[model samples]
Target: MKIKEYRTQFINALTPIYDAGEAESFFYLILEEKKQLKRIDLALHPDLAFSEEEIAVWNSILEQLQQEIPIQYLLGKTSFYGLDFEVNENVLIPRPETEELVDWIIKDTATPRNNQGLKILDIGTGSGCIAISLAKNISNAQVFAIDVSEKALATAKKNAQINAVNVTFINQNILETEDLQQQFDIIVSNPPYVRNLEKEEIKKNVLDNEPHLALFVEDNNALIFYKKIAELAQKNLVPNGQLYFEINQYLGKEMVELLEKMNFATIELRKDIYGNDRMTRGSVQ
Candidate 1:
């Protein structure tokens, strides 16, 4: 069958569940991945055909998409911070807002005070996105990442290798550790900050498919991970070391307050592209 004709059927099948724009996007994403054909290629040719075997594979993916499985997991890969990462049920798919948090760190460390050797750590580094991105961008950074789930760490280690960056992956729960045991110039995390009450706010695709261990916190103690990581930062951060977090949009005021009470200097709360308070930074004085 002509690929154009199949594209129409594909979009129509998903338009009931996803919007027209999203369904169209899924069509093109699949087209590029499966056929190595971009949207323009299909548009210009208007005669590309899908073999019966290819149709079977696409139909399988379409069925899963209808079931609300994330396209990243369906594709088994995603792009973040200009690098590729393999994602699965074991890790949360990295988001664009997290990229903003990473950009902030990259710019901040572009000209470090001591550039010879810089140490950095990422807490709850689910996919190792932040750690690997920083290590890839910053030439002198020695990056380390920690996660409680060994399975998550395995994926992260693979990502580090795939990105050709060295990030020491550690399998330890940050909440259970007494000391970081070493000092770092920077510490960053995009830990579980979604409150239970906010589950309704999450889209069905994410809530149903993403790992909850990397997504949720008790509503009453929404800052549990932040507070614990901040305490550890107090002991582990070097003098004037910086800390960064991708936080829940609703809890910006509370986050700034938490860092303030902990005596963090130069605290800055920044909004993401959507104008939501999505990232915060504090420096140890």
Candidate 2:
């Protein structure tokens, strides 16, 4: 059938599960990925027909979409921080907010002669997005990432390879680790900060499909990972070494206070594109 003709059916198939806008966007993204056809190509050539086999393949994918599967998982790849990463059920798909966090790290570390060969660690580096991006952007930095899930680290390692960046991947439970064996000039994380109570606030696509190990925390101790990481940062970071986090917008003030009580200096919180206080940074004195 003509690709343009499929658009209506595509929207209809997904409308019950996703909104019109989201369904339409998925259709376009799939068309581009599968057929190498742009939106304008569909618009300008409404009669461009799909082969019977192509239609069948699209039908199967559409059924998955109707069942609420994420488009990124369906494609098995996603773009983040200007790099393409392979993702699956094991790793959370990198988000634009996290891209902002990566940009923040890159800009902060790009100063001339500033820790040019410094060691850096990215905690909870699901899909190795932050670690790989940093290594790709900062020419002289040594990067490493830690995750408790071996499967997640596998995906992250693949991403580093695909991005042509060298990043050491380690599997360890950060909360249980007593100390970092080696000091780092920078430590960054986008750890699980969503409280159990706030699960209702998360979109169904996220709460249903994304890995919970990478997304949640106990409501009573929502800052558990941050606290532990801060303790390690105190002992592991060299003088004036930096610590960065992509934070929970709702807990910005608490995070700032936590860092302050830890005696972190030069604490700063910044808003993301949505104007939420979504990232924070501080330096160990």
Compared with the true structure, the alpha-carbon lDDT of candidate 1 equals 0.93
Tens digit of lDDT per residue, candidate 2, span 179-280? Answer: 999999999999999999999998887888999999999999999999999999999999999999999999999999999999999999999999999999
- Candidates' C-alpha lDDT: 0.93, 0.93
Which stretches of model 1 miss by more than 4 angstroms? 112-115
How many residue pairs clash (N, CA or C atoms closer than 3 angstroms) in each of the candidate models, in the order given?
A: 0, 0
lDDT of 2: 0.93
lDDT of 1 by residue, 74-187 (tens): 988999999999999999999999999999988887775654478999999998999999999988889999999999999999998898998999999999999999999999
lDDT of 2 at 273: 99
The TM-score obtained by model 2 is 0.96
